[model samples]
Target: MKKIITKELVPGMVLADAVLTPKSNILFEKGTILTQKDIAKLTFYSIDEVLVHDNEIGEIMTISSLPDGQITASERIKQTKEFQIFKADFEKCAEKFKNEISDLVAGNKEFDYKRLLAPIYELLQKGQTNSAVFEMLNNLRNYDDATYTHCINVALASNILAQWLRWSKEEIETATLSGLFHDIGKLAIPEDIITKPGKLTSSEYSIVKTHPQKGFDVLKNVTISIHVKNAALMHHERCDGTGYPGGLKAPQIDRYAKLVSITDVYDAMTSARYYRAPLCPFIAISMFEEDLQKYDTEMMLCFLENIVNTYMLNTVLLNTGEVGEIVFINRNYLSRPTIKIKNDYIDLSKCPGVYIQEIL
Candidate 1:
């Protein structure tokens, strides 16, 4: 199963998913083969893409890249046209903080706490602005350096969650600070261990688990609130008491720590790593659902409903050699949704024999 853009739509190709409108109504169904007339009608909907299962070719069709000559000056300008200026400013702050992370871990006597908190202050000017900035940075252009980029991404996501939870202005600032510095302890660990392309040995894993305590020790003397300190110390702890450093369970771990933990796992799962390719957001969400016991149920639900909803729309795909668009979502069971292809409706919740084999 695969996804192909509208330009690739052709007669005889089956839909793996369903095509849906914003109103949650099906436009087509799974297993419905495309026709020339159907393709012509799709343009009216402003749909630029569709997922199709091409059994004859043995793959799903997808638009791989932007078209040639499409990278105009206007396009580049649009890229920099931020929906929220504060978010852009916050990213600059994150970048500056990243520069001193190594020095903090090396026990530098000159590390400055006020300077470290500057980004957090900038991120809290307005909750809505901060949230917009967080979203913008999450979709920011990638850099070759994965560690720095991953850290920033995690910080942005964590900050958004904190804002959504309606933490006090002061608490939101501390949460952002904690998230930005949560992985600072990694600097004390060997670079080889941090960037190893293979699985870690048991001894290496033990060293890796020491990051939380290491981060806490580095910030112990720093002039910051206790909320910030605790978040850094317990971001790796789980609700199920199955996480590392200290296996503190629910209630034992602070709410801020739990919030950071969820964001940490989400960023790690979605970012490309030395050992594996980045997982798709949908797949990562599913994985989190399966491990719901490991996180705060209310927070996890908020993250999914509020944050993820923005990205889950109009996604086309193939399911078991058929192509379709997602017409509706089953919040309780995200894996099974109503899909529309050409002219059919697939009620996955009722179709025991059908399954989504791939994401186009």
Candidate 2:
């Protein structure tokens, strides 16, 4: 299969993989012949590229006529092995980051942004799309207290959001680095408090709130941009003047800080914590919608749109205890999307009380 940009998609091209809606709905199935409607949907979803059979582009090759049931055993094994390798590499990189962060906290030394940011830059450049990173993030959410991995996830998310906003590549890179250093101060906090399984006392919570300031102190002197330093200090500050440390309002908050702040909350909310299980991405979107005033609305909107689209074509469990694939998304009501369960299509906008429970 060859990957091609959305514009290259034309009628009669066979899909090598399913196309999904932003709501995790499968807009088109693999091996289905494309049509004008399908191309329009792909454009609407802002999909960058899709995998198509080389034969569809005029390359001659033997076609497999095997019946499509569940994935073949060999295909499943290949996917499993690929996931294992991805997970292993991610953990190893995170471990190196943990040690580097430790050194920064212990000796009060300059951060090696070159070394720390290398992996993220490479991942972004290599993948050149959200699919790979999104898959890794979904898997990472199952683990606990992976600080380095969380940082990387936030960085990637910030970059994606910035790119979606049509920001300059330089700005995106800065936003990415800002996210990486946003939690640097957490390294100074006591591990017991950081990973406490129960609710924290006010004093303990107060300690936790000091991370932004501590993080700023650590990064302030580093040979990075002022935006990066301020982002670390102000990521916790809210738009309505209700955040920690300085409690700076929206006008007072740095733009870079604003971007990192969204991703910071996103990664934290989606990741499993000692105190609670991870929330579904849909829940996170709901929270963002409800608290839209607390964040930069434009940034949040871009993030919501792009992030949800990454789940397109994914299998999900519904609140009604049925399994389905997302089939359509109502732009006005992003959280409620039409789902396809076998032959039945469930339009969530029309069916109250039916909601997505989890992405499988």
Candidate 3:
């Protein structure tokens, strides 16, 4: 069995796994044959994906058009409540972890690896799918205290990227932990500069740039893999010899650092900042495209495929005030995807007049 986005769902396919409603009730049993009506039913439930026999997935010749109206008021409420649950739990974990790390650094004590990683592992497992984790990240913008939350968000993104890259279990764990500790040096920066509502002076900016090296110093004595330690030091290093500290080129940068750098930029750009408000994910993608030399293109492409393309079945509002569901991604242009608006499949890449205003 293989999981596929609902946009790719077609009639005559058999469900390899049971389809459950958002309320956890079984809507369709495993091995059940899917028809147009069943497909519509799943769409109405805001079901994103389903598992089908691997052989059956690619056998469909046509994709039946379905109107988009998946989310209900109740589902919105449920999603909000779900976000709250995750928010509460994340806050608790962040607080405890932050305190523990502070104590570990201040007292020169050994890192409590088990205690430090358990909550993160639990959170990752709780989300289950990459889409669910990204959804949680989108909802997290509703809360404050971005410092601790940013660490958690980056770690989640890093782990997801690691999984997408098909890394080993130990490598994934190290990458996740490395993301959590990447910005540890920021803790040493003065609170006023860290949270400054306005532009910083040249000296302050220079201090801010020292975070990577300072973070490396903090983790130098810690009992973690060298890759993990290097992640803290090199995450800011760019591919074209333009990053920070040593300004190492692509070949000089560590592989783990390259992976973490993508996620770090993604979360940092999408998250609200003291200098400016958060940009939309699409805007962030455009930013990456504008400055391709500053990142690992291969890793960035994989991240876009995993993180951005997961919104395949999402409803979006266009600049023309029309609503549509994203049906396909344009391989040549990741941001300008094909949208299904009623009976028409509008390819944004070809249509120069209209653009997506927001993802509904």
Measured by TM-score, the strongest candidate is: 3
| Residue pairs in collision within model 2 | 22-309, 25-326, 25-327, 26-326
Candidate 1 Cα misplacement greater than 4 A, ranges: 1-94, 108-114, 117-138, 141-145, 319-327, 334-337, 342-360
Candidate 3 lDDT, tens digit per residue, 1-360? 889766567667889989898889899999876744456456545587899987664233232322486663224634676667776778888897788877755746586766878898888877768778787776576326456677888888898888898889999999898888888888878878888765467899899999888888888887788988898899999999978989999999988888888888888767765323455576566557656787888888888876667777887766566778889987667777899988999998898655664555
Candidate 3: where are CA atoms >4 Å away?
A: 1-81, 143-145, 274-277, 352-354
lDDT of each: 0.66, 0.75, 0.76
Worst 10 residues of 1 by lDDT: 57-66
lDDT of 2 by residue, 114-143 (tens): 788787776665554666666566665665
Query: Mind giving the per-residue lDDT tens digits that candidate 1 earns over 238-324?
Result: 999987778999989987788888888878765554423344455566667767999999989878766445434334444355666
Ranking by TM-score: 3, 2, 1
Q: Provide the lDDT at 322 for model 2.
A: 78
Pairs of residues clashing in candidate 3:
none
TM-score of each: 0.68, 0.75, 0.76
Which window of 10 residues has the lowest lDDT sum in candidate 3? 57-66
Mind sharing the TM-score for model 2? 0.75
